[model samples]
Target chain A: MSRTSSDAVVVHQREPFLRGFGSFVADVWAARTMLVSFVRKDLMIRYRGSALGIAWTMVKPLVQLLVFSLVMGYFLGFGDQIPAFGFYMFTGLMLFGLFADQLTGGATSVLWGAPVVKKVAFRRELLPLAAVGGALVNFTFMGVVLLLAYVVTRDFPNWHMLGLAVPALLITVLFGAAGAMLVSALNVYARDVQFLIDVGLLLMFWLTPVLYPWSTVQNTLAENGAPSWAFELYMLNPMANAVVAFQQALWPGVDEAVANAAAQRAAGEPFIADFDYFDSAFATRLWLMVLAGAVCLWFAQRVFARLQTGFATEL
Target chain B: MAADVLEPGVAVSVEGVTQEFSLRHEKTLKGLLVSRLRGRHPVAERFRALDGVSLQVPTGSTMGLIGHNGSGKSTLLKIIGGVLTPTAGQVRRRGSLAALLELGAGFHADLSGRENVLLNAELLGLSRREIAARFDDIVEFSGVEQFIDTPMKFYSSGMFVRLGFAVAIHAEPDVLLVDEVLAVGDEQFQAKCLGVIRRFQQEGRTIVLVTHNMGDIEAFCDEVTLLHHGVVRAQGTPRTVVAAFRGLLAEDERERRAQSAGGRDDPEDPDLGFVRVARVVVRAGSGRPLDAFVAGDSLVVEATFHAERPAPRFVGTLDLYEGGTLLHSTSTARLGVPVGPLEGEVTYRFTLPDVPLGGGRYRIAVGAAPDTGSPPWHQVGDAAEVMVALRAESSGPFALGVTVDRPTRV
Candidate 1:
């Protein structure tokens, strides 16, 4: 608050290479209050006039869970063998919804706040960060719905659920923030990127094991005589691994007989899979995914900083 | 004042700051790719909006930037405000800063006026606690108390600007950057806003204002900088800088007139060259041609037309303009005045029995056209310049006679 010092703030050309990254981090940290305000405003304005308001957050995922469960569990008869198919699908859908929302929202964050971005001098990264943060808030609301589903079904979560779910959720958010940062910056130059992302998210939703489990993918690969590297490459998708991690945390008591039967029925079907929740190799791969996500976050921050220099002109 | 005396500080210092923007001709990847396939490189033309401009602002003085459009006055202000970063050099500031770079720049239309006040204040760098403490005062200052809870989309533009200005001034930053936002709103509100800014000046806050209004620059600024083509052309006390700015503007206008006159040899419409407006003269009712006239005096505007090819009929139009705003316009065709067939030269005159205009510099524009659905044969803007002197104190575009009456002792 003191205004008398001449040396308090100096803005100069950033140092070349990675040296300025540290200062960038420090700047973002200093503007954390603005970031929080942005996120709060984003969430409030989004639901301001809606009758359902914040309830729409929970309602969207719940509806997605019911529709997927009804189609895959009844008509398709794929979920007949998976015990508590609805809850399993809900966990994956919840995580996927959070990831998708963050990605799309992050991509448009800068463009959406063009008025502020062009006129105000602040940490521009806060825009995408707020977008991801707002998605996380919605994710928390859906988490409550998940908890409610657990109580209704008389299924209880153990301490291991906390141990695993918290890290899974964090990793998902980190991945989302990274993706949002990259796409949002790209979106400023190419409006086509927004539409590309819409199509990409649809493809990614099917690619990830949101409605199904991971086992079906593996079994189908084995049956098709595909090489093992294909399955490894498939597992390398961070969202695929994150979805498995979320399922493991939320639906640990899946009936194996029913799961296998559903797996048998879902053979050769797109987006139907049964995951191995306790696979040591999958856990290791999930850890690697988290590390990769962190690296991506770092890279995205650098790209965003470089692109943001021209945001005012571009906007 | 205490801080200024204690520190003798420089509030803002710009050192060799240059802002370069890459103007991309192709914004889409597909367009870029198509250009690549055609053996052409997608071009990004670099423009230097601010070219190594450096200045030092003392802690407690108000500085005004004056320039024509695209002269980079706003760019310099933005750079100082930190809304834009220079591509080279550096900027150092002594204290917290708030910028009114654009009025209502970030207010959400769907949000109520009260909500936008909080949002805009915080965006300007005020903390939530500070905004909460000063909310009532901000609202009162804006005079939008009745519409505080109404969505901003429903509010008038004046209300929006008032609220935006109110929040910005209340932010109490050490350095304030304002960019022509005072040009909006009513006269009373504009005066109120300027009063707050004057108060800020008295409190020793550093202010940098960008405006095209020479009056404002003279009235408010301790010093002035006049920019031309992204560089400072003049910098000194308000009087010297404003004079230089006006000189530059007049020079520009003269060059533009020369160019336009040279280029007008080829008429767009073939029939337009049949007749041309040669001269325009303005005279008082006393029959003396004068450059300046007093309000309520009878004025006569006469335009002479020379016809190269005989025209069957013609309509002469006269227009009076103050600055860019047209005050009054009349056409002989509209007034049912008859016109011309025979040709060498003809003079048409329109008389205003009482010039109702208030004091201001004014221009007379004259044009002539074939009366039968053809484009104007010749049109001349500012064919004659006249100054209207105020007979008495007045406001607005015109002065009307007023009668004051006292209430009867019923």
Candidate 2:
């Protein structure tokens, strides 16, 4: 490690490729205080003048969960077959909220921090990373809400739940951070990337099976004699596996028979009779998604390091 | 020449730094795509804002960067401050660095003054504990203690600059780069800011300043660099650099006036059939043409006019100017000098008993008008030049002698 000296500061033309990436991360680590301060400022300014203040962080996710459950359970009438249907939906919705917040926030971080990016000399990666950090703070609040919903519905979590939930949340945050870095770097030169992300997020939401159970999609594919590759491709979306992991972790004892019968009547089809979320097959897929998330993060960091050299001029 | 040596104690060294900016004709993706379809390049031009500029600053020395607008002084400063990366070469500095490149450059308008101070200090590389320790002193120095909690958006622009300057200086940087931000706030605060800068110099810190005020450069800088067209035209002591800058300005002004006179004319305003100023001259009392003089020397200005048409009366005015600023104007009517009816060519001379001016270069503006309260028939700016040697140090537009008497007992 190179020791920092107050007596000397050397500035040179930025190098490209791997050498630049290494120094960029080192610079960010040295300015960790700035990153932390930016995250705090982002969080504070977000709820500064509102009456409910930070409570909105929880209230927003809670209200969305309530509306989705009530409409699907009462108005659309899928409540009877599935035990603890609200808890089931809440788990997926909270996780999706965390992912969506980071996706949009990180993508716009550079444009939003134009003032500092154009004027100050620091690691520009901190801007998008801070956005991810801010989203994580909000996600933590929603996590508390998710636990409360499980408790109120009489779905007590066990040790296996803790083991899955920790890794699930970590993978989701990692994936979101990676996605944020990629989009934010592109958005600096082409602002159309920001709007493209909004459309992408909407499309990914339905694909990820956040509101509907993954078994329903699986049953539809099986009954139609669809190609096995269809099911495989659907699971390839990291968020799809993330949502399932979160659901299995939060909704313990998910009464397989009742859920299959409810899913059948709701969609007028035969749902999968035996679905094991904690089976080795599902765990391997979850771990694969975690690996994919790490790869994405590494790629994003490299792209961010390369793109940031022009940020001062572009902004 | 002596200051050009690079010693081991050099605080900042800039070597062959070149900066180029692409001037894109299209800023949006749609415009860029349209241009591509039309087979037009997106970059309309490439501007070299800095061209192989090199300089070395010794430890504890103050360097002033003086240039006209778009001369690359600010760009050099930004490169040295690390806010910009040159396309070629590099800048190496020894010591902790802080730059006030632009006043309130990093401040968040929605954040309070106190929050902004903490945020800016940390961005400038101060630790949280350091900011906490110096928080009170920063606020006191800024003189915004009463409104410290108010959001910066509500504060006056002067307050914003004051708080920014305070936090920057309090960071205790070993090398400071300042742009022309000191031209803010009241005169008293500006003086206080200069005092702090002087104290920084006394403490053996390196300072790089960019300002248009020649007086500041003369007073503060140990050495000065004059840039023109993205290149260093002169660099040395303040006097030599300032003189070169003034020469550049005079040449630019002369070229501008000649270009305007050559091709531009107000066609709607026909030439009035009256006397017009033809030539102007300045001479010493000893009957010799003079371009330079000392204070308290007798001087005379002679103006010759040609009357294209007969006029009942005419008045010619000789105006003295320093740069673009008009200093003194004496008209035949105002000075109570007699002017007979004008016909053909005529000459008039105005005399000053003593040239009540200080050191510096100046120009003359001559105008001839009919006594009919109409606009001047012809006016020629930059009619002549005068250089006055400094006799005693003084401020303001001109020099004045003064004396002081001391009482035996107080």
lDDT of 1: 0.77
lDDT of 2 by residue, B1-410 (tens): 23333456788999899998877645466766786799865356679999999998888899999999999998899889887778888788877787887665577777888888887898888888899999999999999999999888899988988887898899988888888878788998998899999999998888999998876887799999999989989999987787778768757864664455432121112343467777787777765455567667777878899887766667888788775567987788788867557789988888888877777767777787754234465666666667776555574557777666796795
lDDT of 2 by residue, A1-315 (tens): 011234445675355554455666678788887999999887777788899988888886778777877887677665554556777777788888888888898888988777766666777788888988888888888777766766777667555555667668878888999888988888887788888899999899889876676766777898899997898889888888888788777765465544565576788764443335535777777777788888778778888877776677777
Model 1 per-residue lDDT tens digits across residues B25-129: 677779667766887633356788888788888888899988889888888877787777788877777877878776654667778898778877877778789
Extract clashing residue pairs from model 1. A81-A258, A81-A259, A82-A258, A213-A273, A213-A274, A214-A274, A214-A275, A215-A274, A216-A274
Every candidate's DockQ is 0.26, 0.32
Q: CA lDDT, every prediction?
A: 0.77, 0.78
Candidate 1, residue A47: lDDT: 91
Clashing pairs in 2: A7-B95, A8-B95
What is the C-alpha lDDT profile of model 1 across A1-315, one tens digit per residue?
A: 356554536643465555566777797788788788888878888899899987888887777777887898888886765667787788888899999989888988998788777766777888999899899898889888777878888876444655567667767988999999989999888878888989999998999987766777887898899998888888777888788777777774554533664666568545444544635665666677788888888888888888887787788
Query: Model 1, stretches more than 4 Å misplaced?
Result: A12-17, A158-162, A255-282, B1-8, B35-44, B262-410
Least lDDT summed over 10 consecutive residues: which range in candidate 1 chain A?
Answer: A269-278
Model 2 scores what on Cα lDDT?
Answer: 0.78
